[model samples]
Target: MTHHAYADRRSGSRTHADGRPPAPPPLPVAARRGPAGRRLLTGLFLVGLVASVLPWWLDTPAGSLTDATATTTAAGQITGLLAGYLLLVQVLMMSRLPVLERVVGGERIAAWHRDLGVTLLVAVLAHTAFILVGYGGLTGRSPWDQAGVMLREYQDLVSAFAAAGLLVLVGLTSVRAVRRALPYELWHATHLAGYAVLLLGFAHQFSNGTQLFRPGPVRTGWIVCYGLVVAALVWGRLVGPLTVNLRHRLRVADVVAESPDTVSIYLTGVRLDRLALLGGQFFRWRFLTRGCWWQSHPFSVSAAANGRWLRLTVKVVGAYTGDLRDLEPGVRVWAVGPSGTFTAAHRVRDRALLIAGGSGITPLRAMLEELPPGAALIYRARTPADVLLHRELDWLAQARGVRIWYVVGSRNDPGPRQVMSPDGLRRLVPDVARRDVYLCGPPGLVEQSRRLLRRIGVPRRQIHVGTFEL
Candidate 1:
């Protein structure tokens, strides 16, 4: 249908003469757990940092830093401690732990992991450099010579160096330019080396560190930290998925094309009514097809959980997603989650404005079923042919009292620009500043919409963004 047709239809229906719907219901009681959860996690992180440095602070006398060599050595020890602690924290962030996913959300966790990764790399490199320089100064040898001596004489030093090398490799690939150049599978495989890096560096800490070389409370505490991290990894990464898959026993029920490039995969399983899921959450799906069994990819449910089946709409952008178009009925599927916080439960206001670009409409479409009446959607696509599920969106608009606008044009076109601008948005939804805005799209569109929304006086906390860029 043409854009004008949609606007005319809306005007004749539930909308008033001015083409605007009635005011949205008052803001609901917002979820209060998120702030408390953040505070608790922050406090625990601070406590961990203090505990990491406590051994050094207690063992070293006030006059111990009497010389440059002594200070450098101390710095190396401290950095080592911090690096080890942070590595554990980083692993936990991506471990798929339900508590972290629930409290912090996947998008924020991914952001924290990425920003902290740079700090971890710097700490590791600094520890290596400081130790070499400090030891060399004390022994009247070059730093290079000291490095060679440590590698030859110290236990696990070889593995530590290897771990450092692997870390450097991971960091290099994680650069935006390099990561985009690499295939998803290749990047994912390389990223898993983080676990190996942790394992390889483990013995060096207890075997050679000044504070942990001998048995003590500090050493025991460090060991417990390792144990806890291991437990979290085992449960979140392995046991949790295993339990979900065994219980659901999901299989591909059907696959239907939504557009030339998009297909919806319907999944049926045992006892689906018992599966606890939110509308906008996603899963890491591993199809047990011969060629696709080894890798899993994250996709959001394209429809709300309806107790009978689940659906995931995917755009065939790569080899893996393209392969999904050929998936046959009854193929077994292994899925990892009901993860993310893009659902109504996380909203800070009763009314919401969802802005979607291209395939980013997938999650927002599912969320429309669950949000209260009188929400609005602005879907931006380059062409009319690129718009997916407009017929369903139209039905949803009437059934749920939603106001949807299909903004189709090139980014530089005046129509799209004017509709997405701060003034234009306010004209369409005058109470936009009082509603939660859910923004999902390509990175560029999301960034631009975010800037426009902020300019129109939407509070940052009310602007919830959905991203799957872990």
Candidate 2:
């Protein structure tokens, strides 16, 4: 339907006849609690940092750093320790545990994973550089010759070198520019090489490192840290999905084209209610189809789950999504999520203002159906043709007393019609600042809207942002 048609349909919605929405719904009790997990995670990071350096400090003799060789060795040990700790942390951040995702949000976790990965690469490089220099200085040999000697003499030095090279490759591909240049499948596959790097690096550390080789509290602590990290990875990433897929046996029930480039896939499985997904949450779904089984793409639930049914609307953005339009019924599926914190559980106010861009409406559409009345949705699209699920929005407007505003105009229009700007936002939703805002979209739009929301007097704590970026 055209934007004008949708406008006319919603003209008589009359959710409230006073030219104002009703009083906002009261915020849920769970929403008022502060982010306890964030604080706890930060504390753990600090503790880990201290633990990482404590061994080197305790073992070093007084005035050890007075000698250049000792100083270089000490610095190398510090970098190695930090790199090892951070490598484990990178795994933990992406363990995909529901409790962690609920507490810290998936976006924050993914971002932390990327940041820590970059830092880990730098530390590993520094560790190599320092170790080469220190050993070369002590042995009166050139750095290049010392490197060959160490690799030939050390137990796991070859594996360590291989791990470092793999780490560098993964890190380079993860760069924003490099990632965008590659296909999602290629990038994702490249990213998974981190697990291999971790394995090789771990062997190198235990076999050659003096700190970990010593039987003491430091070694015990390293063992415990690695053990927990391995357990988390196994359960959260591997066994968790395997168990869920076996129990649920999710399969495609139907597929309906929602727009020229968008298709809504209906999934059904045994005991789907057990999944317990929130309204605006998403899953990394892998469809067991010939052309689509290799990679799982994250898509928000387009509608609330009803016992055995779940729906996700996907836009044709890349090869994976483009192939989804042709997906048939009865395809087996495996999912690894319900991850994110954009649901009503995170709301901080009674009134909610949901801002969506393009296909970002999927999750918000689900939220509109499940959220209490006194919520308003502002959907921004580049043109009338880009607006999706208008009929459903209007139906909700009439049935559930929720206001729906479809801002259909060219985003690139240089004039006054860019509804995403601060001025346009204020004009569209005069009471926006009073409502808790939930935003989901591309990175650029989400960041820009966040800034606009902040500038318009919306407190940072009251605005929740979700992104589609991996």
Give the winner by lDDT. Answer: 1
Instruction: Show the colliding residue pairs in model 1.
Output: none
Model 2 Cα lDDT, one tens digit per residue, 1-470: 11122221113231323333332322222453366768888998999888898888888878768888978988889999999999988888878876787778787799888888888999999999999999899999888998999988986999899999999999999989999899877888888888888888887777778788878888888989989998998888989888988989999876777778888887878997687777788999999988888778889998765565788988998777888888788999999887887787778677789989899999998877666677888888877878887777766786667888877665577542456778878887888998889998766668878988989899988898878876
Backbone clash count, each prediction separately = 0, 0
lDDT of 1 by residue, 1-470 (tens): 00112221222232222445532222323344446787799899989987888888887999989999999999999999999999999888888998888788777888888888999999999999999999999999899999999999986999999999999999999998999999988998999999999899999998988998889888998999999998999999999999999999999877777777888787889898798777778888999999999999999987777676888889999899999999998999999888888877788888999999999998998888778888999999998978987766877788789999999999899989999888889989999999999998888899999999999899998998888587
Worst 10 residues of 2 by lDDT: 1-10
lDDT comparing candidate 1 with the true structure: 0.85
Residue pairs of candidate 2 with colliding backbone atoms: none
Top TM-score: which candidate number?
1
Error of 1 at 111 (Å): 1.6
Q: Give TM-scores for every candidate, taking all chains together and pairing residue i with residue i.
A: 0.92, 0.90
Task: Give Cα distance to truth, residue 42, candidate 2, Å.
Answer: 1.7
Candidate models: Cα lDDT each: 0.85, 0.80
